[model samples]
Target chain A: MATALTRLPDERLAELLHGYRASSAGPRRRALLLALTIAFLVAVAAQVAEVDLPRLWEHAGAFFGYFDRITMLESGAGRVWADPAEWFWGWRKWGVLLLDTLLIAYVGTALGGLGGFLLAFCASANLVSNPWARGAARRFLEFCRTVPDIVFALIFVIAFGLGPVPGVLAIAIHSMGALGKLFSEVVENIDMKPVEGANAAGASWPAMVRFAVLPQVLANFISYALLRFEINVRQASVLGFVGAGGIGQDLIEAIRKFYYNDVAALLLLIIVTVMLIDLGTERLRHRLIGALESRA
Target chain B: MNRAVTLRDAAVAEMAGIAARHPQQFRAMPPARLRALALFLASTGLLVFGLWRLEFSPSRLVDGFGQLVHFLGLMIPPDPGTWSRTMLILRGLSETLAIALLGTLGAALLAFPLGFLAAWNTSVNRLVQFLSRRVLDSVRGIDALIWALIWVSVVGLGPFAGVLAILTSDIGTFGKLYSEAIEAADRKAVEGVTASGGGKLHGIRFGVLPAVLPVMAGHVLYMFESNTRSSTIIGIVGAGGIGLMLSEMIRTLEWGVVSFIVLLILVTVAVIDTISGRLRAALAGARAG
Candidate 1:
C-alpha cells in the first residue's frame, strides 16, 4: 500500500499524509487546549481565593484536632457512648426547635405553593394571551427567586421580630417564586388541545385555567412543590442563625460556646431530621406522581 | 315483520329510559373523588392550624407589611460608603467569587472518584456503594452554614475556613449528583469497549467518562453559581466573606450600606447566571456538533 501510494504522486502523498496527521492530531490538540485553560484558571483562582498550600499544611492538624475535640467526651469522661445523657443533654429544647423548623417549612411550602398555583397560569405564555400580564408575572417571580431567602428572612426578622414567623414568610415568598417558575414551565408544556376545547366552549380565562390547565399541570406542580419543600426544610434550619427561629440557632450557639458535645449532638439531630424529610418527600412525591398518572 | 318492529321499538325505549335515569354518569366524579376531597379538606385544615400555631394572624401580617415598607424606604439611595469602603466591598466580592470557584472545582475533582464508586453500575462492591451514598446524604444534610461554623472552629476564622466549608458541603452534593449522572450513562458504549477486548477500567475511561463529562461539567457550573450565594451567606457566620460585612452592617443598622452590599450581590449573581448560561449552551452546542 505504501509503495502504491508513493508511486501515485508526490503531491497526492503529501495531501494524504497531511489529512491523516490532521485527523490524528485533532483530539490531542483539543485536549491540550482544554488542559491549558484549566491550568490557567486554577492558578488564577488559587491566587484570588488565597488558597495557600503552606497555610493549609500548617492548619491541617488543627482541622482534624477540632473534629477530635467535637467527638471527645467531657474532660474526665471516657468514650462518647458512655455519656449518652451528657451528649444529648439539650435534646428537649433542640427537639422543640427542630419541630418548629419543620412546621415553618410546612407553612411556608403551603403558602408558597398556593401563591405559585394562583400565579402560574397567568405567567405561562401558552395560557395567558396578554403579553403584559405574562411579563409582569414572570418578572415578579424572578425578583422573588433572585433575592436569597436569607436576605428576605433578615428583612422579615426586622419587621416581624425574631421568631419563626419571619422564617415562614421568607420561605413562603422564596418558595412562591421558585414554585411559580416551575409551575409555569409545566403549564407551558401542557397539550393545548384541552385548552382550545375550553376556549371553544366560551369559557373565560379563569374557567379555562381551572378546567383545563390545572388538571394537566397539577401533578408536576405538586412534584416541584415537594422538591421545594425539601429545600425549604434545609433553608428553615439555617434561618434560625439569623434569629428567625429554628434548630440552627441552637447549633450555632453550641459551636460558639465551645459546647463540643452539644454541637455534635445538635448536628446529628439536624442531619437525621433532614435525611428523614428527604426520604419521606422522595417517596411521597413518587407516589403522588404515580397516582396522578394512573388517574389521567 | 310486525313482531320485529315492536321488539326494536321496545329495545330503543329501554335504552332511552336507562340513559335518562343515569344522565350524569359519564361526567360524574369518580369514586376516588371523595378521597381526594377529604385529603384536600384535611390539608387545608392543617395549614390553617399551622398558621394559627405560628401566630400568623392577618392583622399581624398587615402590621408587618407596614413595617417592611418603612424599612424598605430606608434602603433607598444605597450608599457605597467611602472609597476605601468601596474597595473593601469589592475585595469581599472577589473573595466570594473565588471561594465559589475554588470550592466547586475542588468538590468536582474530589467527587469524581467517589461518584464512580457510588454509582451502582460502576461500583466495585454493593456495600461500598451503599455506604458511600449514605455518607454523602448524611454530610449533605448539614448545610453549608453549619459546615462553615464547624470549619471556622477547625481552621480559624478566615476565607480559608469559608473555602473549606463550601468544599466539604459541596463534596457531598457533587458526589450524589455525579454518581446519579454516572449511573444514568448509556451502557452500550461500555459494552462496545468491552467487546473490543478492553478492560473494565478502559471501558469506563473511554466510554463512561466521555458520556458523563459534559453533564458533570454542567452540574459543576451550576454548583459554582449556587456556591457563590452560599459563600456569601457563610460569611454571615464568620467563616469570612461578604456575608460578614453584610451582617456587620445590618447589626449597626446601616441600611444604606446593607442595601449597597445587597445590590452588589444581586448584580454579581445575575452576571454569573448569564455567564454560566452561555457557557452551558456553548458546551451543549459543542457536544452536539
Candidate 2:
C-alpha cells in the first residue's frame, strides 16, 4: 500500500491531501464575521471595564510580585518550605477553623440535598400535575440558585449574628436551588414504562412515585448531591469572609494585613481541603453512576 | 406423570429449591438495600453532628428564621432609593458585565497557547505536559474570590483588580478545559497533515484547531456566564463590580435597595443566560469548517 501511494506524483499527493479539507467560502465568511463581532465586543468591554493596557503593562509586575511575597517566610527564611515550622505557626487555629469549614459544608450539603430531593418532584413537569405547583417550585429553585451563596451568607451573618449557622444556611439554600434543577431534569428524562406499569396497576400517586421514579432516579440524585457537596466545600471555605464562619475570616485578615506567609498557608490549606473533598466525591459519584449503569 | 401429581406440588418444590439455594435473595430486601440504609443513616448522623457543632440548635434556627422573615418583610415593595443610587446600580451592573467579558476573553487568549503545552497530544514532551497540567491544577484550586482578594492587595482595588483576579483563575480553568478538548480531537486529521509534509505548527493549525475551536468556544461561552456571577461577588471583596453596591446596601440596612439590586441581578442573569444559550446552540449546530 505504501509503495502504491509512493508511486503517485508529489503534486497528486498534495492535491489529494488538500482536497480533503476543501469547502465552500460561506463558512469562512461566517467565522470571520463571528470573529469580528467578538473583537468589537471585546473593545467595548476594555473601555467599560477600565482595562488600560498601559496601566496593566506597568503594574503587571506587582501581580507576580504579590505571589513572590506570599511564598516568602515571615522570618525572612526565603520560602515557606525552608522553615515550615515558623510558616505554619498558626496551623493549630487554622486546623480548627478548617474543621469548622468542613462541618459547615457537610451540614449545608446534607440539608440542601435533602431539600432539593423533596422539592424536585414538585418541580418536575412529569411528576407534578399541577402547573402552578411546578412553576412555583421551579421559580423558587431558580431564585435560590440565582442569588449567590456568599450574598446569602452576608445577609444571614447580619440577621443571625455571625457564625457557622449562617454559612451552612447560605450553602444549603444555594445547593438546593442548583441540585433541585438538576434533579428535576433527571426526573423528566426517565423511562416512562415503569411509571405506566405502576399506573396501570392502580397504584396511588405517591406509591407510583415511590415504586417507579425513586428507583430510576435515586442514583442520579445521590451523584448530583455529591457534586454539590464538592462545590459547597469550596463555598464554605470562603464564607468566613462575610463573618458567616470558617477560616475565611482569618484568610481575609491575612490578606488585608499583608501577612504574606499566613495568607500562603491558609490558601494552601483551603485548596488542599477542597481538592480532597473533590477527589472523594468524584469517586463516590463514579461508583454510584457506574453501579446504576451496570444495573441497567 | 407419576412423579408430578399436580402443578402446585411441582411449583412448591421449585420454589423451595430456589429459596434454599439463594436464601438472601428470597428475603424482603437485598444486601445492597441494607447497605444503602446504613449509608443513609451514617451520613444523617454526621450531618446532625456537624449542625450541632455549628451551633445550629433548634431554638437558634427558629430565631434566625424569624429575623430573616422580618428582613423579608422589610424588603416589601422594593425601592431603588434616589435616582442617583439607581443610576449607580445600573453603572455598577454594566461594569460587572464588562469585567466578565474582558476577563473571559483575556483568559481564553492567554490559555490558547498554554493549552497546547498541557495537552498530551500537542506538547513538546511528556515533562512539559505534566508540569503545565500540574501548574494549571494548582492555580485552579484557588477560587476566583480568593484571587480577587489577593489581587486587591496587589493592584489596590477597582475593576482592574477584579478583572485580573477573574483572568487569573479562569486561565487555569480554560487551559485545562482547552487541553482536554485538544486531547479529544481526532488524530486522523493530524496524521493526514503529517503525511502531507506539514510542520508541527501546520499540523496543529490545520488539523487540530479546526476540530477543537468550536468545543472551546462553547466552553468559553459557559465560562463567561459563570464569570458574570463571580464578578458580582468579587466586587464584595472591594473590587469594582455591583457586589460592592450590594454589600453596601445590605450593611446600611437598606433592605429595599438591596432587594432592588438583587432583582436587577436576577434579571441580568436571566438575560445573559438566554443570550449565551442561543449562541452556544448556534456554535454547536453550525458546521463552520
Candidate 3:
C-alpha cells in the first residue's frame, strides 16, 4: 500500500493528502463546535437556575454536615447498635405504614395492569382495524401518561379526602398509561401467523386475541407490569408526602421537624425495602421469561 | 410378534380418535399451569383484601367521582389570574427548565468518570467497581423527592435546591446506565488499537468512546426530560420551582390557577418530549450511518 501510494503522480498524491486532511479535520471542527455549544447552554442554564459556584462551595460542608448529624449518636448514646430500641422506636408504626405503601402499589399495579391489558388491543393498530378507535385509545393513554402521577395524586387527594385510595387511583391511572403503551408495542411486534390463522378460521375478534395475541404477549406484559410495580412502590412513598397516606408522611415529617435519627432510620428502611423488592421482582421476571422461552 | 403389532396398532388408533374428538384438551398441560392458577388466585385475593384495607368502597368511589367531575368542571377556561401572577408563573416555569437542564448536565459530568470506574471492563480494580456499583444502587434507591428534602435543608429553598436534588438522583441513575453502555461497547476496535501499540487510555478514547458516545448522549437527553418532571415534584417539597406555585394554588383552592399551571406543565413537557425524541432519533441515525 505504501509503495503504490509513493508511485502516484504528484498532483494525485497532493489531492489524496488534501482529502485525508479534510476528512480528519472535519470531525475535529465539529467536535469543537459541539463542545462550545454545550458549554454555552450550561452556562446559561447555571445562571438561570441560580447555581452559583461560590454558594455551592460555601454550603458544600453543610450537605455533608447534615448527613453527619443524621448519623450522630444521640446525646449520651454510645453507638448505632448500642441503642437499637431507641433508634427504631417508631419501627412498628413505620412498618405498618410501609406495608400500606406496598399494598397500595400492589393494588394499583394490578388494577392498572388489568386496565392496560383491556385497552392495549384497541390501541394496537395491527389488531384494531379502525383508525378512529386506535387513535382515541392512544390519545387517552398519552393524556394519562403526560400528567405526572403526583399531580394526579393531588387531584385525587382532594376528591378522595386524603388517603391511600387516592394514591392507589393515581398510580393505577399512570400505570395504565405506561403499561398500555408497552403492551400495545408488544402486540404490534407479535407473530402475525397466529393472528392470520385465527382470522381465516372466522374467529371473533375477542377469540382471535385470546388465541393469538395473549399467548404471545403475556410474558412481556407481566415483565413490564412487574417493572411498573417496582417504580410504583417508589411513587407510592412519595405520594404519602401529598397526604395520600404512607411512610412518606412520616418521612417528610421527620425531615421537616428535623428528627435526624428518625429520618436516617426511615430512609434506611425505605432503601432496604425498595432494594429487596427490586431483587425479588428481577428474579421473578427472569423465571417468567425462562419458562415462557422453554415452553415455546 | 403379530399379536404385539395388532395391539400397538389398536393403541395408536385409540389415541388418534381421542385427539380428533378433543383437539384443545389433547394438548399436554404446561408445567406452569398449576403455579399460574395459584398465582392468579392469590393475586386476586390480595387485591380484594387490599381494597378492603384501603377503604376502597364502591359507594365512596361513586361519591368522590361525582365531586371530581364538579371540580373538573370548575377548571374550564383556565385562568392565568392577574398579569403579575402570570409573570410569576412564567418565571417559575423557566426556573424549572433551568433546574432540569443544569441538574442533568451536572449529573452527566460527575457520572462520566464514575461510570468508567463502575464498568467491569474499565475499572482499575474489582473493589472499586464493586464499591461504585453499590454506591450507585444505594443512592438511586432513594427517591429524588427525598433528596430534594435533604437539599432544601442544606441549601435553603430555591431552584438551587431543586438542581442539587436532581443532580444527586441523576448521578446514581446515569452512573449505572453509562457503565452499562460502556460495558456493552464492541471490543474489536479496542483490540485493533492495542494491536497497533496504543496505550490503554488511547484504546478507550478511540474505541470505546466512539462506540458509546451516541448512546450516552441519548441517555443524557432522556434524563433531561425525566428530570424536568422530577424538578417539578421536588419544587412542591419547598425545593422551589413551579411546583411550589402549584401546591400553593391548590391549597388556596385557586382552581383556575391550578388548571393553568397544570396546562403549562403539560405543554412544556410535551414540547421537551418532541425535541428530545427528534434529537435521540437523529443520534440513532447517525450511529447507524
Candidate 4:
C-alpha cells in the first residue's frame, strides 16, 4: 500500500490525501464558522458606514498634502533625507518634548508604583489573610481601573486645575490599578516554601513578607513597574486632551493650528522615545529575571 | 543559656543583613547613585518648569474654588433636552458599543494566532517568534488615538474608521496580552501533549489554548469596556460617535449639551464596566472551578 501510494503522482497523491484529512468538530471549527459569519456582518457594516473610498481617492492629494505639511516634507523624500543640523533642531525640540512627556510619566509611575505596591501587599491573600481586608483593596483597584484615565484626568483637571499635576495624578491612579493587580498576582505565584519556613520559625507577618515574598518577587515587581512606566509615558501624551499638560499639549495645539509639520515632528519623537524605552525595559527585564533565575 | 543568647544575636544580625540586602523597595525614592541624583535634579527642574508653564499659583487655586462653585451651580439639574435628540444620543451610543464589539472581536481573532506565534515558549521557530513579537510591539507602541488618526485618513471618517482604530490598536494589545498568557500557561500540559506524540498545533490546541482561553477572554472583555470609552474619543476625530457631538458641544460652548453628553457618556461607561466585570468574573470563576 505504501509502495502504491509512493508511486502516485503529486497531484493524484494530493487527491488521495483528502481521505486522511481530519473531520472538524468542537468549538475551534465552530469559532472559524462564526468568524466567517462575523466577517459577512462586518462587510454589511462597512457598507452602512459609507467608508467613502472614492471620495478619499478624490481627496487623496489634499490628504497627502496635509501629511506633507505635518511632516514638513519639501519633497517626497527630502523630509527624511534633509541636513543633519536642520534635522537636529527639529529633532531637538521633539526630544525635549519627549523628555517632558517622560517626566510626566515617571512622576506618575513612581507615585503609583509605591501606592500600588502597598495596596497589592494589603490585597494579597497570603499577606492580608483577612478576606474583608483583601476584598476592600481589590475593590478599590477595580474602581480605579473601571474609570478611564482620561475621565480621571478630567476630574483631576477640574479639581486641581489643569496641568501636569492632573495628568500625573491620573496616570498614577491608572498605574496603581494596573500594577496593583499585577503585583497581587505575582504575590500569589511566589514559592510557598520560604513563606512557610518563615512562618514556622515564628517570624512576624511583616518580617515574613519583607524577607521572603519581597525578596522572591522584587525583580518581578520592578519589571512590572518598568512596563507600567512605559505605558504611563504613552498615557501622558493622551491626557493633553483634557488640558493636562505634556508634549500631548503640543500635539493637540498642532492639530488645532493645522501645523502638520509640528505634529509629524512630535509624533516622530514619541515613536522613537517609546521604542527606545520599550527596548530598554525589555533588556532590563531580561537582565533582572535572568539574574533571579541564576540565583534560584 | 550562652548558646541561646548567641542564637538570638545571630538572628538579629541575619535580619539586619537581610534588611541591608533588600531595603524597602516600596520607598518610592530614587537610588542614592549618580543616575538617581541626576533624575532627582531633573524631576525638580521639571516640577519648577511645569509649575511655571501652567501658571500654577496657590493664590489662583484659592480663587478658583469660587469658579468651581459657580460651575457646579450651572450644572444643577441634569437635563436630557428634547426626546428626539436624546434618542439620537442613544442611537449614537449603540453605534459606539457595536464599534467596540466588532473591533475587539476582529483584533482578538487576528491576534490569537499571532499571539501564539509570539509566545517565546510555544512558537514554531525563533524567527517566527521574533517577527511576531516585533509586530506586536509596533502595534501596541503606537497609541490608539494615533492609530485612529491614521485609519481616519486611510478609510475616511465614520464608525468604520473608529472600528479600524480600535481594531488596529487592540491587535497590538491583544497580541501582547495573549502571548503573555500563553507564556504563563502550564508547561506540564504542553509536555504531556508532546509526550503523547501530539504535533505543535495539537499541543497548542489541547494544552495551551485551554489554559489561556479564560485569561484571554478576561483581557478581551476588559478591552471591550475600555474600547467603549475609547470609541467615544475616536469619535472626536469624526469617526461618528457621541464624541463628535460632545466635541461640537464643547466647540460651540453649549455647556448644557456638553454636560448632558458627558453625563450620558459617564452612564454608558459605568454600565458597560459593570457588565464586563460580571462577565470577566464569571469566565474566570468557570475556568478556575
lDDT of 2 by residue, A1-296 (tens): 45444478889989987776566456678779988998999888777778777877776898788788899876676888898888899989999999998888889988998899899999998878899999999999999999999999999988888888999999999999999999999999999999999999999999999999999998888888888888888888888999999989999999888888998999899878887887888898888878888988
Q: Chain A TM-score of each model, in the order shown?
A: 0.90, 0.89, 0.92, 0.82
Residue-wise lDDT of candidate 3 within A104-216, one digit each (tens)? 99999999999999999999989988999999999899878878888888888888888899999999999999999999999999999999999999999999999988989
TM-scores of all models?
0.90, 0.92, 0.92, 0.68
What is the two-chain DockQ of model 2?
A: 0.68
Shift in Å, residue A124, candidate 2: 1.1
- What is the Å distance of residue A71 in model 1 from its true position? 2.5
* Poorest 10 consecutive residues by lDDT, candidate 1 chain A: A1-10
Q: All predictions: root-mean-square deviation over Cα?
A: 5.1, 4.0, 4.9, 7.8
Error of 1 at B126 (Å): 1.3
Candidate numbers sorted by lDDT from highest down: 3, 2, 1, 4
lDDT per residue (tens digit) for residues B7-109 in model 4? 9989787986766777764345646545757966986676566555545577765655565566566655756568987887776776777788778888989
Clashing pairs in 3: none
Docking class of 3: medium
Interface RMSD for all numbered candidates: 1.7, 1.1, 1.1, 4.3
Q: What is the lDDT of residue B78 in candidate 3?
A: 99
- Candidate 1 residue A268 Cα shift, in angstroms, is 1.1
Residue pairs whose backbone atoms clash in candidate 2: none
